[model samples]
Target chain A: MSMLPRRVEFHEEGPREGFQMEKGTYPLDDRLALIDALAASGLRQVQCASFVSPRAVPQMADSPELFARLRKRPGTRYTGLWLNESGFERARACDNIDIDGKVVFYVTEPFSQRNNNCSVAENRERQLAWIDRYIALGIPFEQAYVVTAFGCNLGGPVPVSAVTDVVRWLVDACADRRIRFPAFYLADTMGWANPEEIKRRIGAVRELVPQARIGLHLHDTRGVGGANVYAAMQMGVDLFDSSVAGLGGCPFAGHKHGGAAGNICTEDMAFMCEEMGVDTGLDLEQLVEAARLAERIIGRPLNGRLMRSGTLAAMRC
Target chain B: MSMLPRRVEFHEEGPREGFQMEKGTYPLDDRLALIDALAASGLRQVQCASFVSPRAVPQMADSPELFARLRKRPGTRYTGLWLNESGFERARACDNIDIDGKVVFYVTEPFSQRNNNCSVAENRERQLAWIDRYIALGIPFEQAYVVTAFGCNLGGPVPVSAVTDVVRWLVDACADRRIRFPAFYLADTMGWANPEEIKRRIGAVRELVPQARIGLHLHDTRGVGGANVYAAMQMGVDLFDSSVAGLGGCPFAGHKHGGAAGNICTEDMAFMCEEMGVDTGLDLEQLVEAARLAERIIGRPLNGRLMRSGTLAAMRC
Candidate 1:
């Protein structure tokens, strides 16, 4: 009756996601220190920065320098986020940053325009062009992200058909190019997912592409991120993208208040997975230390709970 | 395969739980305002105060005055917490406070001594005396709370047997007195529950007393509180005790940091339930306003998400 996975993979996104949304400008050394701490905590992949316009996201303007100065850990992949071809080129220019060909499509048009300044159809065409370039550059296709897969803040209550349509499009595009279909990541960009909605969406996507591995990019914007993760795991989803200390919020999400939560906390999710007898391969103590360091660097309290409560392992000790 | 209840009941404990854990002394009017706001938000039961030793919880020393000046909302039951006969007497003396006899036992000995200042065995004896008093006073017995039902910070992981033992004791005690067995509320006094553990423990308790209703009093100390609530709902748990704006942390739980979270946020949980199509008989906008009011009174941002992110219903409109 239990559909839980035996192991779960987490991609840490605190540095890129957390800092970009923050109003204050942090020192480049502080950013690198946070990423280094995350990598040292045994996170296999740490999203170090976002390669976007400096005028738009002033906090992430030092993406290239951050990767250049990062103390890379063995067995860890340093990654970055890029929305357009130019941003992708910026990431590819950095030798230390991991470059894998990835495509993204928005589930809703309003979000697509606001987040990427392009229509959904236009974004699809852009992804096709990127696919051709990836094939030519010998870069392995990593995954396609379906942003706002659950529901959009600008456009409410996304239909499951909309999500499946994007997945179907990705499948057809890969097939047309004679390339294998990569994994798919369903992103709840605005924290609009409930547990049942998570299950329904995952089931729908799985029904369409049974062979593709599905990952979740959830936000705790409305306090159900952990439940959404649990729901996905019950459907055997093993991949997650989380932020350390629950650090990042999307500045474009149109939240009225300053306290909009970021992605589900990395150490909190890892703690949940490990406590349920699932192997996360991350040290709780190290992650706790990283979370605390992140809080100290930010000079404010972050939304993470494990950093404050201490791990149950410590209590057992 | 979905076992979620069609309608869920929530008992708001913000005024008692949130304010007691808060360090600053709030005005009595502010406390009454919060309770009134919670009741107006369509919460059926609001726990306004705790009748404990003033020396122990100075914040709640004005419980009697709080009840006296409370603007009673029709069809809403204003309740208060009491752990002993003296506390019970104080609550009984308040004409406006809804008095229902409740019993509590600790799953772990260490938590029992620290939280209630008595051993588990001594607490059981005290509960027996309280039961006799309830019978003598012709008061209706409401429920029995199994504190630290999941795990204890001081005593480590609690066995499922430890939980069932308390449930069995409660059932037997009611049977001995020829009274109907009351509902059992499992309190995660320390935030140690995971989703799998929630299912396993709820299943174990149900097997022992199939007819008795079960409620959960959870803390979001280390996150996963929402997931635990969802897991319990999958087993058809309809009753929950929550704090508004996620206010309140146990002063005795030994959290090193000041940012320890309280009970799961009432508005956030209600938002989750409503979004999932479960009727919670509460207005989301009203609850959100109440949560904001709580934040203002606490003079800090509370750990709720919906108050910041707004609601899907508003977006759809």
Candidate 2:
């Protein structure tokens, strides 16, 4: 109980994650509306778009237009994701998007090849080059993402040692360049993590990088996402990456059975945190409204519980 | 970690809970097929029907016939829910249904009046009468359920003391009759419980009855159902009542907003337990099949995750 954080931070990734996986084209206006709604909901960070190829992700092809038109909230940090130098350059070109340097490494080579179209060594070299460019441009590093940190659908179960090894590598990479590693985000890219696995993996990462600010990017694909969030919070890991209305699914995850579910829902996670006496710094009603907006934009019922059932505060009133 | 249970018992409430809430009539064959599938899935206890009025719950009108035609599996305990003497008599008339005497008390008056069609006192008197009848018949007592034990939609937040008072009353009532009080099941009837609330309320209950086994009947209405389950498990509370394919919303919970979600999904919960090394004595594959069958019967996508994403073991294979 003592280990639970009194406050937690959530990064909204619905615009980037959700739309990218959706089947049809949504108007740029609808996307912007959802993003603005999320920013107004008091989320400190909002990943509004991804600078990926239109051919790869047709929905995110309007990334530059989204950034150009987005009404940026003063307190909220608007961010975008990019996987390579070309994507990074595209993100750098956006005036409204916050250009924070971040690096990514895959825990499994199979996922790395499938998602990034590169070998593990090739991806690392690309990341290192980006790190050098960031240093040269005086851009402060945001975090290092360890994708498939828990387990991979293509690569099977991930060992705690494998997670620790990734963290250790990222730490040493930053140390060698005299740059302090800002944070480490462990991503359950394929929704393979359970609550126990979450605790074990986080503990293992902490053991390797004792002072690193650890965060989670968990998928609710398997339905234990809320449990996983609670487990992480119990360990005082306050940072999380979530989607509004649980918008996105992993396009890379084997969707032959059904498409993978999205990240732990934002309003649902925020509602849980606030209910448990953890300060989420977000408005529940506003988040719910945003979730509803997301649902309307998607033109379907997204996998979010709080959006459907609402908050306890609303119920009490 | 040491407080976590090595094994947990799940009472399948899908057939009884799901059908009673669904709108439209389902064929007797479809209902029996689901119940039979659940029984064959290694579930020890399956609540197959509710012997309630056809006017109130048209879906459960076939409960008696359901019991008569159900293929009774040797190891499974086929059960039915009955609120009053008439319903009890209907259940007693069924040759195949297992009859274990159970009592219920409401934590709040408004919900008591609304759901049970009586005040708390009147409901208690009815339960007492049923208890006497059970004793006369030499029927074994199962457990007592504390409805809206966490909070109520109409009655607002329920205090910890309110729950313990009901438990204390039930304990004393049984003691006065010289019958030992069976287990206490704290039900989050309207999905009002958060993880912290679960821990706090369970702790309060344990203080009053340290020797008694405690169980949870949690709703995933607000999305913290999985988290609440984890919190209870950490306290070594092993018994749970879950719905297959996340079936059955509370018809009583205000549906003016979107209707309340169903119970914490059985396959999802079981998947979490199994992945965390908690023995459930149920087959994951069989449960997935059952969940799909539930979706097909309902003619809609049920709110279950494992049924879509699949188990980690399947991914490993």
Candidate 3:
């Protein structure tokens, strides 16, 4: 058997997942520019924004407005995560020339309580209620994502049994023949995963949610993001969630505003995939340009070494 | 098979290897204090200093004097390394209680010429001559060390035959005399070794010199020091050379000093060994004290994160 992965797919996380927690006030024009650059790189899907309470996440205040302005590519799917009825309504009211009739919803219990001032039970009820709204609107459920399947900040180590129960909720949401099964995604909000961990939990996810398309959204805290991705990929995970110039972080992770501290740089991810004989479709040069643009917009170095040092090894003289 | 190594040992590398290449002048008293601090940590063996030409390694100019001043501790065999007859003679002249009949002659070849400013042939002639002198002075030859048996900077990937040839020269010097054969220590002078490289070369060494006690002295130039030590330890290597605070770097390698720059922290090695279940007989608290002392002497924090963070895991709760 080959040690290398056989195939690869890419996702651009810059617009929504990358800057959702960023304290720096980014203009919508700059956000659009970053998205345009990333979309130009040929990434198929993006975790665009969260339709959550603006008072809770002011950084995502203009989430709907920003999505309204994007000149999205034909094949690219923009996924906006929602938690409650109000946020889903706000996402549904957004004006877009070209858009799909699917909506993604996630229930981050420990985080929803902290960030949304609701109990875990309330958050779960609200998310299930939103799925009912999705069925009422006749939107397809195959495009929706149930994120943070791994664990949460306040609740540590999401047991595979817990995830198994959560997938049951998704399966029920698609019952009654109104919607297809919701797509699944695992989000490591606190970025604490080793390769063995990925193997254990992701292997469980594969067993439980075998038919659902899964994407892994990882944080690079503790220097294990890329290795975790490599592990997941080895276990047959095809889709990945990453930010250009290594964006995104938790507001409360203490010491350096999250960003997984040393996050998995997308350019580095591209390099890792290519080196391991996997194709990411996104060109390296384009990704580098996207990183440079994001860095200028974010007003800091992305803290990725491969971008600083050229990707290819220097030829021996 | 275990995903982690079946067995692993970490070599404390900060004091001996780190202090030797540093540019700042350290007083002999300070050097003694540093060595004492390192020894207090209970590290099995440290590669004290090379007794080569003072002009070539001016940093170790007072090695003989330092040997004289060492506060001898019982069961702690004070070891000294020599590169030639002149060095061994100088070391032998010292009548200190610390190293009366226990000084080990260390002469490495190939890259040894660049380090000692003498050809391999000249080094062999001198080493053979000094072995006789050591016998005459009644110093034990068991403490003697032949370094760089793996590969060299000046001469790449040293053939196994070259190390065997050097051992044969040692055999000829013995003249059928009965004494313990000198330990062979492989050195990564320029740090080009990978795990595979170490595994292959170590196999070759054990194949030829099965009876010779083998040790590894590695520098972390390419971030493989920990991996290499882990590999060697798994292969049954017990003896390794380390410095307190990870203070040294090969001047022949890249620049950028300080704890974060190059050398692997001695505490990291200590931590690795302990976690991997290998008993290195090291005192963690004492090593931390010693590491901080080494850092103060160098006017910089040495590369030991464990010292600052404390070796034990702190409770998040």
- Candidate that would win on lDDT: 1
lDDT of 3 by residue, A1-317 (tens): 22434667777666776677677668889888888787787777766777887887787899878888878787677767665567677877876522334433344556666765876556566666656665677665554444455555455545666666666766776675556665567676555454556667766766766877777777654334654676677577877777776677543445421223434567767766664567888777677777778878877645343443333333111
Model 1 chain B — which ten-residue stretch has the worst lDDT?
B250-259
- Across the candidates, what are chain A's individual TM-scores? 0.96, 0.96, 0.83
Model 2 agreement with the true structure over A171-242: per-residue lDDT tens digits: 788889998877889999888888888888888888877888999999998899999999999887999999
Candidate 1 per-residue lDDT over residues A36-82, each given as its tens digit = 88888889999889999999989888888888887778999999998
Query: For model 1 chain A, where is the 10-residue window of minimal lDDT?
Result: A250-259
True contacts kept of 2: 0.74
TM-score of chain B of each: 0.96, 0.96, 0.79
Clash tally, candidates in order: 1, 0, 13
Best by DockQ: 1
Candidate 3 docking classification: incorrect
- Model 1: DockQ score: 0.73
In order of lDDT, best first, we have 1, 2, 3
| Regions more than 4 Å wrong, model 1 | A250-255, B250-254
